[model samples]
Target: MTTPIHVMSEIGKLKTVLLKRPGKEVENLTPEIMERLLFDDIPHLSVIQKEHDAFAQALIDRGVEVLYLEKLSAEAIDAGNYKEKFVERILDESNLETKPVREGLKKYLLSFDTQEMVDVIMAGVRKKDVTIESNHLSDISEEEVYPFFMDPMPNLYFTRDPAAAMGDGLTINHMAFEARNRESLFMEVIMDHHPRFAGQDVSVWRDRNHTSRIEGGDELILNDKVLAIGISQRTSAKAIEDLAIELFDNNSNFEKVLAIKIPNVRAMMHLDTVFTMVDYDKFTIHPGIQKNNGEVDTYILEKGEKPGTVKITHRSDLQEILREALDVPKLTLIPCGGGDAIIAAREQWNDGSNTLAIAPGVVVTYDRNYVSNDLLRRHGIEVIEVASSELSRGRGGPRCMSMPLVREDLPAR
Candidate 1:
């Protein structure tokens, strides 16, 4: 039987993927709370939905099965007969101040059918929208001006962050920020009870229950034997170490973990923001991540002689390290914006380097990064460009918006 989650390589032929179509969650972002919600500006929901549909269709055209996270979450609850359990978990994590408010919110949310309830949670709940007949001073004196009973998850459309698939298992991540922390609950439910995934023997290498943070945006499966994780704003070095130890001790078919450290800044929040694998021996890199000497901090982790320990080696040459990891004699490092400083920064901000590889030499990218797209074509890669005016506002391209569920293994080069 084929595994429900089987992603061993970044450049494999994508068989199935998970995506969240832009919904009211994105529309709920007001200018005041947008930044706090990890969104730059409020996206036009209609336009963003159109663009996202195009993205799903693009994948469908390539023979990739596309699954919607919202639908899957609702289905999982129904399939497992856990609606009450799911709602309770949501309220528990919603940070409702008192038991009275929690119970009131729970009652309000439970009135809807499963799918509507799920969508309402994603869109967030405003205090004004739900009536509570509470005379308690705690509820009466609290700030009424505060917008929501639960904050909207604006980053839900970027399905790559909540969890990531690797080998035959997946990591339901403990996200770095409060804005994204609750997003993984949907993945946990889906993996545990969804009809397509339950009883499938899918492993959870790491769970979202930890305190240390690790995001899927920083996790990249370089090949069957190597993984490249980023130590960046969203992923802590400690999390990388923990994941490495788990994979090594468990025989997860991963032999090496390259912890690539990039500047911990907003624009380059995750490793995939600055780096990604495109083909067997080719990758797209944002020049901003490298020093003047073309150096970047890297730590190679391998199985140690002592059980549960890892052997660590430091390296600064990313190119050489990747070549050795993939076992290719030579490799190509395609710089975002063709290594042009200004264009690189501009395009990289729009996620020019975050290209999703569907097949060996083909990628899905944002059309706004024309220079980067043209350069990729010159490098002998087939580039499929998608509309990004509204989607780009969220600061994620095809790769950031996608989480591959199943991928056909690459033939030997």
Candidate 2:
């Protein structure tokens, strides 16, 4: 079998996807850390896992290959040298100075399988007494030293935030928050050294100083010829430009890059929050934001023999522009929440617009986004709703639960 290359053309034809099943870290989310971790509330791990499994099954049922990130990361670690480098990087980045804690972390990293490793990394080392060196005039006894705390990575379940697939390779996104930086590092190691993806080129948003930060959710590959990047709260203009330069330098497939600026609102943290493609000529969109009256600005960067040029202007709806520019005949726009003003507003806030397309006319969504589901069904689309009581509390739905790695282009309808 040939090693799979990443080149997504349509959401429906996705052949491979990356997912992280919710774990103890998700359950441990407290109100205190919810906002810090970019969550609205805590969720029960069991329920969330069940829902995620259903979503995964939906994709599998459609013959899509689902690769759990935790599994891949674990297998990558078994490669020996790469594992050591990954561990050292984690230790150095986390700044844990306690000998016992460091030892515990090392042991944990070596002992767990892929699934368990994912859990421990997210749940984190328990708070316990740790030995540390001290240089104080009045020395406190080592026995009385307090336990050093290791904060659980509540946001790790949202794997879409750290790294993104760009063309045939990957881009390791530098995260804005320090609390989640370790997750990014973990993704970087996996994409760079994993056995399944050996010898693949990788891109980094940051330079040696590590100032750049971007997220996969904010990045969208419209086609081999175009990329739709969202400039949102999580992704900066500078980061987009940096990514553009990298793409220009390495990838020869893309001809244009569109920077769609979205409001920095908590609700609209990424472009996928407002728009996502479901089929070759169909899309689910939050018109309120992607339209002219909305808070986003659309710009196009066309590539030539040399590095491309950018053009900015007010324009028609994203769906309209994409349809006209790409010559897609009879593009369909499915509204979230059944197109009812009230329902659309409420459901969209609950991640109604965020559905992951398994294939043409098939998708996964939150059961709680009833209005959106109703709309999808009315459009003759199949809506597979996963339980959301626990999953919804985390402020993400089906789309956030999955990261598509490879998609086959659909023929024009």
Indicate which candidate wins on lDDT: 1
Tens-digit lDDT string for candidate 1 (183-301): 99999999989988998889899999999999999999999999999999999999999999999998899999999999999999999998988889999999999999889999999
What stretches of model 1 exceed 4 Å from their correct place?
Answer: 137-144
Candidate models: Cα lDDT each: 0.93, 0.70
Q: Taking the tens digit of each residue's C-alpha lDDT, what string does model 2 give over 7-101?
A: 55546377888888777777666676678767788777777788778878877887888887777777776653566566667777776655655
Worst 10 residues of 1 by lDDT: 138-147
Question: Which pairs clash (backbone N, Cα, C closer than 3 Å) in model 1?
Answer: none
RMSD of 1: 1.0
- Over all chains combined, what TM-score does candidate 2 have? 0.86
Worst 10 residues of 2 by lDDT: 139-148
lDDT of 2 at 318: 65
Runs with alpha carbons beyond 4 Å of true place in candidate 2: 97-118, 129-148, 200-210, 290-296, 304-317, 339-341
